[model samples]
Structures are given as C-alpha cells and as structure tokens.
Target chain A: MRIALDAMGGDFAPDAIVKGAIMAAREIDEATSLLLIGKEDVVNSLLKEYGYTGNKIAVVNATQVIEMGEHPTKALTHKTDSSIAIGFGLLKMQQADAFCSAGNTGAMLVGAMFSVKAIEGILRPSIANFVPKLKGGYGVILDVGANAECKPEVLEQFGELGSIYAKYVLGIDNPKVGLMNLGEEEGKGTVVVQAAYQRLKANGNINFIGNIEGRDLFNDKADVIVCDGYTGNIILKMAESLYDVLHEKGISDPFFDKFNYEAEGGSPILGVNGNVVIGHGVSSPTAVKNMVLQAQKMVSSKIWERFKKNYNE
Target chain B: MRIALDAMGGDFAPDAIVKGAIMAAREIDEATSLLLIGKEDVVNSLLKEYGYTGNKIAVVNATQVIEMGEHPTKALTHKTDSSIAIGFGLLKMQQADAFCSAGNTGAMLVGAMFSVKAIEGILRPSIANFVPKLKGGYGVILDVGANAECKPEVLEQFGELGSIYAKYVLGIDNPKVGLMNLGEEEGKGTVVVQAAYQRLKANGNINFIGNIEGRDLFNDKADVIVCDGYTGNIILKMAESLYDVLHEKGISDPFFDKFNYEAEGGSPILGVNGNVVIGHGVSSPTAVKNMVLQAQKMVSSKIWERFKKNYNE
Candidate 1:
C-alpha cells in the first residue's frame, strides 16, 4: 500500500509534513510505502536535514503549491502541478492507496468530489470527524461542515457511511448509529430530521439507535452520530473550542488532552471512491504523521471496498 | 410590582418553588408583591414551614398539575387551572407585572404564545440563553429551541428581540448582534443563514457584526448571537455538557464555574407581550430564586414596553 502526502499543505508546510512523513515511514510496515509530494528541492532538503534513511520513503516532486486561503476549485484548476493536485493524480492512477492533505479543506473536498468522484449510488459524499468520548473510545460524527444543508435522503446516507466507517476504521463491531437531533423522541426535530428518522429506522443495514442530542456528543451512548452538515459542523467546532479554552486557561487533564487535533490526525472524506483524509490547516508534525498512519489503517481495512459492497447489498 | 410564581412547577415542586419564592419575596422591595400560584394547601404549608412570611407574599390556588412528560400543548389546554396557566392568567389580566416557571418548557412556551400573545409585528417569539464568557460577563444567545427551524425573517426578528433583551435586562450598551454561521466569511452558511445575514447587515436598527462561528459562543466577540432554534438549541446543550463534563471530572476554574445554570438563572421568552422566564425543570432552590429575580429584573426594566416602542419606531 502506498500513501501519498501533501508535503506543502499545512501551516508548517515542508518541515512538519516532511517530519511527519519520515516518522510515519519508520512506523509503517515495509510493504506499506510513503510518497511525499511537493517541490523537489524543498522536500529533499527537509528529508536530508531530518536524516531520513528509510527504504519505505520516497519523494514525488510537484512544482507548484496551493496556499491555505485560495479558492479550492480555482486553485485546483489553475495550479494543476501543485502538490495537492499531484497527490490526487497519484490516487486516481491507483499508484497510491490513499491521499492525505493538511491544506485548504475546501480544495481537498473539491478534489475528492471532482477528481476521484463519489460512489455510484451516493447522493453526496460526507466527511467524518472523530469525537474523543469520555468512555476511552472514539465516536464518529459525519458531514462535519461538508454538506451544510443536506436533504433527508442525504442524511440517511450519512448514517450508512458513518456506520461503515466506524465499523471498519474505528473497529467498532455493530456500531450503534444515532441521528443527531434536538430531542430523543421519535418525532422531535425539524422537517428534514423527522423525514430522515423514518428512513433511518427502516434501514436494515445500520444499527439505528433512534435520536441523540448534542450533549451525547462525548458520551458512549452511540458509536456513530449522523446529522446535516450544518448542525454537525457547529457541534464539531464547538467541541474543538473546549480544548482551546482548556489550553488558554493552562488547565490540562487526561480527557481534554485527547482533544488535541494532532492525536486524532485528520477528518476523512467518507463515501468517496478512494481513501482521502483532510487534516487540520494548523496540523503539526505529529498530526501529519498520524494522518499518514490513519490512511494506512483505512487502506489495510479495505473500507472503500467494503463500503461499495454494503451499498450494493 | 407584582410577580406571579409557578409554585407547583419544577422537578422539586412546591418545596423548591415555594422556598425560592420566599427568598425572592424577602429580597424584593416592600412595594413589590409575590403571588404563589399552586395548590393552596401545599403552598401555604411550605410557607408556614419556612416560618410565617411577610404580607408581601400571597397564595393563589391552582388545582391542575402538568407533568414533565406530557405533550406541551395538550397539557396547556387540558390543565387550564395548572400553576403555569394561572400565572399566565394573572399576567394577562394585569394582576402581575411578570410570570416565571421552572416547569414543562413546552407548556411555558405554549402559554406564552396563546395566553399573553406575541407583539403585533413580531414573526415569532424567541428565547434567549445566557452564555458565560471566558473573559467574565455574559453574552446573550437567542432562539434557543423556541422555533426549531426559523425562516430568515424570523431570525431578523430574533436579532431585534435579543438586542432589546441585552440592552434592557443585561444592561449592555448598543449590543453588537451577530448572525451565527458555520464560518465567519460573508457567504458561509446554510441558505437561510446567508439570507438572514444580508437582512441583518442592511437593517439600520441593529449593530450587525456580520458572521460568527461556534468558537465565538464563549468569546466576547459579539454581545448577541442569533441563529435558528435548532442550531441554537444544539449549541446551548453542547455548551451545557462542557460544564457537565468539567464538573464530573472535578476540574474547577472561575470561568467554567460560572457555567452553572443556577448563576445564569433561566432563559427568557423574548418578543412576547409580557415578561416570562423559564428555568430548568431540575432547578434547585437557588436556581428557582434566581429565576424569580430574573423576572423581577425584566419587569423593572420594562423590556416588553421598550420592545414595543422599538418595533413601532
């Protein structure tokens, strides 16, 4: 398995990305390779400075770099030779098992949708975030800023995708999936949520556990929580701020310490044809390293293949 | 000023409600009176147990009781003689300056809508929750589960109602109102939020600050944050859970300590014809006392009258 890394993506750029790639290369099996995609000199110099001597690591040079604030589509279209663009090209050609970027999220999402394309029957591809649970395990939350205003059918699909990801990626057996709603009752949400509830309840593939409120975000009540991207995004960001508050106050604890973005690595674009993960823009070296490892785990688990099979079933 | 209290409302009804009323009665001015509405015998016994009270306190009999689990509208209609009902009746008849309850949220909302009625031009009444800021002081967030899904026009009304509440009750001078979106950019949310943003920006009545994200909920960026009730409720509950998690983990700081609902009292139903506050159903004696005091503050500020004047202007 070969995982392509966008070395010029994150805030730390070549330094953090290169350092992370080197760390990931050391940990990954010999059969699993790392492809660092970026400008030749910059990446090579970092690899040399870091004293990387791993046979599992290699660099694929791309001349251009896309800045963090650029328009995703415009950047991808105009900067065809950029590292992120080249990373996607490697994944498209089946030269790499997965591609990860800590670059412009909008660009990463755009590349996933237009470059690799969505699955055959999927209405819209959704992104999933890992919420560190109080019970010492992680819960998967989907469409976290992906499709802000999703239709009922689209939310129902998120439930299926989230379930598969949780089961395969997170290794939760028969993951309990709950719809993120205002109330826990049968008919206790907006029009879209109400319609989605009925469909989720009837869907036999997923282990639907009715509704879960925002307070349940960290609880172990459900392994996978699904919602429209609008609600999901707000919940995700709000949870992220808790860590920020704790950091600012100089208070550190075991539970809150898990909230660091670097530990969780990156949020994956689920429901796509290939394995693609988008890390935080401010991703550190450890975060980039974890992103590569996360990609390796997803590929080894064969999540996309299993997803296609489940959808067909 | 006379404030009617729902003596039978809340999880610890009669005891906590009556105790809070007594505490409030003693603290209020001699001219201000308290009308405790509940079963006459139950309320009188509690008052007697707490020792003979002042002449400023009185009891009004209410035979029916509304349970927490009952449907809100059904309970309001069937239990017309309930404490919540009689409290509204007193307010509607000008017998009381304001009314407050720590009862069924749905019932309180229903009674507020049907009993007191909304201000003429108001599209829908919104409830505002107090968010404890990290930098000390508090920010007001509106439509916190009042209207789960609001139209752009309704959100615009929330901005006005929230602004008025912040100015008069909270005493913020020229409150900076913000449209809650997924991102801070101009066009970064659902269609409804984008439309609301445009209207809020164009309206000269409000001090619009463009857009704010979930992270700003605890920050001092804007004094008033407006969003659809669905989003508002989710954020509110999630924020509440952060306090809960911190408490359970034994992490105590001055900032997180202020997250206690008792300190904030209760959420108020703005955009209504009369002052109405709804405390948490599980409110303790201190929380109930705070709710009563909040109602007193609202009445003293004459928020409803000012709201009417502002809307007319």
Candidate 2:
C-alpha cells in the first residue's frame, strides 16, 4: 500500500511532515510505501536533516504550497504545481493508495472532490470525527464542515455513512445511528431535521436510534450522530474548543487527554472514492504519523468499498 | 416588588426554591415580596425547615407540579392548579412584579408567552446564555431554545436584543454583535444567516461585526453572538455538555465556574412584556438567589421599558 503525503501543506510544513513520514515508514509494515510531495530541495533537506535512508520513503517534487489564507478553488486552479494538486494527481493516477494532508481544509476538500471524486450514489462528501464521550465510548459526528447547507436527504445519507464508519473503522457492531435535533421528540426539530428523522427511522439498513439532543452527545446514547454540516460543524468546533481550553488550563484528565490528538490526525473525509485523511493545520509530527497509520487502517478495512456497496444495495 | 416563586419547580424544588426565596426576602432591598406557589403544605414545611419568618415571604396554594418529561402546553393547560399556571396567573393579574421558575423550559416559555406576552414590535422572545471564551471574555449566545426556525428579520431583532442586554446587563459598552455562520465571510453561511448578515450590516442600530464561525466562538471575537434557535440551542447544549463532562472529570477552570450560574437565576426571557427569568431545571439555592438578584437588576434598570423604547426608535 502506498500513501501520498502533502508535505508542504500544513503550518508545520516540510520538517514535521517529513519527520512524521519517516517515522511512519520506519514503524509501519515494511510493505507500506511513503511518497512525500513538496518542493524537492526542501523535502530532501528535511529528510537529510533527520538522516532518513529508508527505502519505503521517497520524494516527489512540487513547486508551490497552498497558503492557508488563499481561496481554495482559486488556489488549486492557479497553483498547478502546488503540493496538494500534485499529491491529489498522484492519488488519481493510482500511484498512491491514499492521500493525507494537514493543510487548508477547504483546499483539501476541493482537491479531493476534484481529484479522488465521490463514491457512486453519494451526493456529497463529509468529514467525520470521533468525539470521546465520558463513558469511555466514542460517538461519530459527521459533516463537520464539508457542506454548510445540506438537504434532509443528505443528512440521512450522513447517518448511513456515519454508522458504517463506526461499524467498520471503529469496530463497533450494529452501530446506532441518530439524527441530531433540538429536542428528542419525534417532531422537535426544524423542517430538515424532522424530515431526516423520519427517513432515518424508516431506514432498515442500519440501527436507527431516533432523534438525539446535543446534551445526549456526551453519553452512550448513540454510536453515530449525524446532522447538517452547519450544526455538526458547530458542535465539533465547540467540543474542540472545550478540549483546548481544558488542556491549556493544565487540567489533566484522562477523558480530555484522549482528545489531545492533533486535529488533523483523526478527521477523515468520508464518501470519497479512496482513503483521504485531513489533519489539523497546526498538527505535530506525532499527529501526522498517527494520520498516516489511520489512513492505512481505512485502506485495509476497505471502508469506502463498503460504503459504495451499501449505498448501491 | 412582589416575586412569585414556583416552589414545585426544578430538580431541587421546595427546598432550594424556598431557601432562595427566604434569602432574597432577607437580603434584597427593593421592598421585596415573595409568593411561594406550590403544594401549600410542602412549601410551608420546607420553609419551616429553613426557619424563615420574614413577612415578605408568603405562600400561594398550587396543587400540581409540572414534570420534566411532560409536554409544556398540555401540562400547563391541564394542570390548572399547577405551580407554573399559578405563577403565570400572578404575572397576568399584575399581582407580582416578576415571575421566576426553574421548571420545564417549554412550559416556562409557553406560560411566559401566554401570560406576559411579547412586547409590540417583538416578533418572538428569545433565551440568551453566557458562553465563556479562551480570552476570559463571555459571549452572549442567544435564542438558545426559544424559536426553532427564524427569519432574517427575526435574527435582526435578536441582534438588537442581544446588543442591548450585553450593554446594559453585562455592561459591555458598544458591544460587538456577530451573526453566527459556518464561516467568517459575508457570503459564508446559509440563506438565513447570509440575508441576516446583509440586513445587520446595513442597519445602524447595532454594532454589526460580520459573521463568526464556531471555532471563533471561544476566541473573544464578539460580545454578542446571534443565531437561529435551532443552531443556538445545539451550541448551548454542546457547550453545557462540555462543561459537565469536564467538571465531572475534575477539569478545573474558571470558565466552567463562571458559567455555573443557575439557569433559573440568569436566563431572563428577553423581549417579554415584563421581567421573567427562567432558571435551569437543576438549579440550586445559590442559582435561584442569583436569579432573583438578576430580576432585581432588570427591574431597576427598566430593561423592558428600555427595550420597547429602543426597539421603536
């Protein structure tokens, strides 16, 4: 299996990304291949600085880097030689089994959609993250920020996709799917959420657990929680901010520490044709290394293929 | 000022509610009068347990109590002698200067709407809460669970109400108002937020500070944050859950403590005809006491009158 790394895409550019790639190449299965995409000299210099001579690690040259502030589509279209574009190109050409980046999220999403494309029967892609609840169980929150405005049908699709992710990737059997609503009652949310709840409840393909309020998210009420991108994004960010503030205050707790992983490591772009992981912009080497491993797990688990099959079925 | 306390409301009703009323009667200097509404015997027993003998504290007979699980309208309408109904009646008859309760939120909102009613020019009343940011400044997140679906004009009114509350209640002069969106750009949110942004930006009544994303909510970007009740409720609950989980895990931080005020004490029903504060269902005596003080402040400041005048102007 081969993974393409956008070495120049994140805030901690070449150095951290290169080091993480080397670390993953060294520790991961010997059969795994690592292809780092960035400016040739910068990548080589970092590799040399780390004294990385592993045969699994290789460098591919790309001249430009997508700045975090640049417009995603504009940057992708204008910077043809950018690391993200070239890495995505490699994934499209089957040179890489998976694509991973801790870069501009919008740019990564745009590039993934344009390059790797979406799975058949999938209307839109979503970003899914695991929120560690206090009960030692994790809930999957989807469409973190992919499409801000989603139709009721799209939310139902997210429920299905999130359930499958929890079942296969997270190793939870018969994952319970829930529609995030303002209240727990059958008719408690907006028009979109109400419609989505009805559809989700009728969906026999998964364990539909009915509507769940935001407070229920911290418990073991549901394994997979799905909502429109806007609400999901707000929830995910609020959780992230909470963890951050707690971590910064030196409040050491095992539950919160579980969420201390680099932002980029755990977020996977779902509904794409292939495995694509997006990390936090300020990811550390440890986070990048973990992301590579996460991608490998997704590839081995055949998550996308399962999604495609279920979607077709 | 005469205040009606729902002795049968909240998780710690009668005990905490009676103790808080006694405290308010003894400490508050506004010629306070308390009409404790609940099962007369139970309320009297709890008051005797606390050894309260203040002339200001009185008991009004109410036979039924609204449970958290019951529907608000059905419970209020059917249980004519319920504490919530009696409290509303006190307000409607002008026998009490204000009504305070830590009961079912839906019922409280329903009773407030039916009894106190909305002031003219007010489309709908909203609930606001304080969300602490990383920089130690608090943001007023409004419409936490009032109106589920909101139009652009309604959001504009929320912006106005939130700004006034921030300026007078929280004492943030020239408070910056933000329209909650998925992104910070003017064209970043859903149709509702986008149109509201345009209207807010054009309106001279508020200090409209463009759109703010979920992540920026913790960064002290704006003093008053406005969103539809659906999104606001989700965010509020999510934040509350975070605080709960962190507090449970022994994550000590000033933010959690700062926001630990009882909902019964601090949640004033904005845009209502008179001073009505809805506390959280799990409010303790301290929170109830604080809410009474909050009501006193609103009364002294003539918050309702000021809102009416400014809304018209």
DockQ of each: 0.72, 0.70
Clashes of each: 0, 7
Q: Write the per-residue lDDT of candidate 2 for residues B1-313, one digit (tens) a residue.
A: 7877788889888788888888788777757777889999998888888888768888999989999788898998899999999999988898987888988888999998888888889998998878776666677888887888899999999999999988887778898999888777778768888899999999898999999877777777799999988998888777677667766666666767665655335588899888888888888888888888778777767788788888677
Instruction: Give TM-scores for every candidate, taking all chains together and pairing residue i with residue i.
Output: 0.97, 0.95
Shift of residue A224 alpha carbon in model 1, Å: 1.0
| Quality class of the docking in candidate 2, CAPRI style | medium
Question: Alpha carbon lDDT of residue B190, candidate 2?
Answer: 80
- The predictions' CA RMSDs to the true structure, in order, are 1.5, 2.0
Off by over 4 Å in 2: A261-266, B133-137, B261-266
First chain TM-score, candidate 2? 0.95
Best by DockQ: 1
**Candidate 2: clashing pairs of residues:** A264-A279, A264-A280, B263-B279, B263-B280, B264-B279, B264-B280, B265-B291
